[model samples]
Target: MKKNINITEEDRKIAAFAALAIVIHVLESSFPSPFPGIKPGLANIITLLVLFRYGWRFAAWVSLLRVTAGSLLLGTFMSPTFFLSLSGALASLLAMLLLWSSIRPWVGMAGISILASISHVMAQLLVAWWLFIPHRGILALTPILIATGIFFGLFNAIIASSIEKRLTDTV
Candidate 1:
């Protein structure tokens, strides 16, 4: 009974994290961008936090929920944009998981952020090429997207690091 209770609590935590991620995603999207797809990716902060706190499985679940819920709410639904966002989030989460498990101890947060950013951009590019622009014309956005992803990744890393520090100290 105690074990089952603990499992329920864990499930609740995952759901709560995913809800927060979705909220962040929506709020970030509300911020006006001069160009499309230049989102701040504020929800990614959640992913980083989950990676440090719970590991890859939880982080991946949060990422998946955030993208799906965010897309549904944002009216993208099953559109190309939704798929692109999903792909990017998955790639970023996977990269964070890999780094946290293997390279993060040696390379640190900055390296993780850079790698995750690159993975996100690449994932979006691949999705775009496969889904929307088979002619590969969306490749033009790669450079700028990569730069933006890196900047946002660094921002998320800072936020995650600070939060982790605060939580650790309090606990």
Candidate 2:
């Protein structure tokens, strides 16, 4: 029989990844945003990292923790914002899986990050349009939000790519 190690390398990787995700989420949330939902998406870097290093399962865990803890700490618990964030996070994770599968490993981090960010923004907008605000004013912000989404998405992609390069060589 094979002996089971009490602390596996994979366990350490998972804990480190989750902690990094939470820290990034908190940092991003702390910074002031011009708009309600816009952030540098620093946390998504961890998602991309996990997707690249471990797999989709780890990536999904990162996303789930990021959103759940983010909402609770930001005091958006049980609100429409919570639901919207949850939807966006899940959509982003799904997009990451899709992009990761389709792209090469060399650029997988950037591709997955960008696609996930776009997916998250779209999900948030859809949730806002349908559930919270159905007014013209809310819809009017779509173009601006979309533009910001692209900008922040690309920013996160670059960061994720950098992190992937830096860490992959070491780990």
The number of the candidate with the highest TM-score is 1
Q: How does model 2 score by TM-score?
A: 0.83
Number of colliding residue pairs in each model: 0, 0
Assess each prediction's global lDDT (C-alpha) against the native: 0.82, 0.78
Model 1 residue 162 CA deviation (Å) reads 1.2
Q: What is the C-alpha lDDT profile of model 2 across 1-171, one tens digit per residue?
A: 999779887777777777888788877777998767777778887887777777888888878977887778888878997899899998898887776666655565555666677788888888888888886677677777677777777887788778777774546
RMSD of each: 3.2, 3.8
**TM-score of candidate 1 to 2 decimals:** 0.87
In the predicted model 2, the residue pairs found to clash are none
lDDT of 1 by residue, 92-115 (tens): 878877777776668655677778
Error of 2 at 107 (Å): 5.2
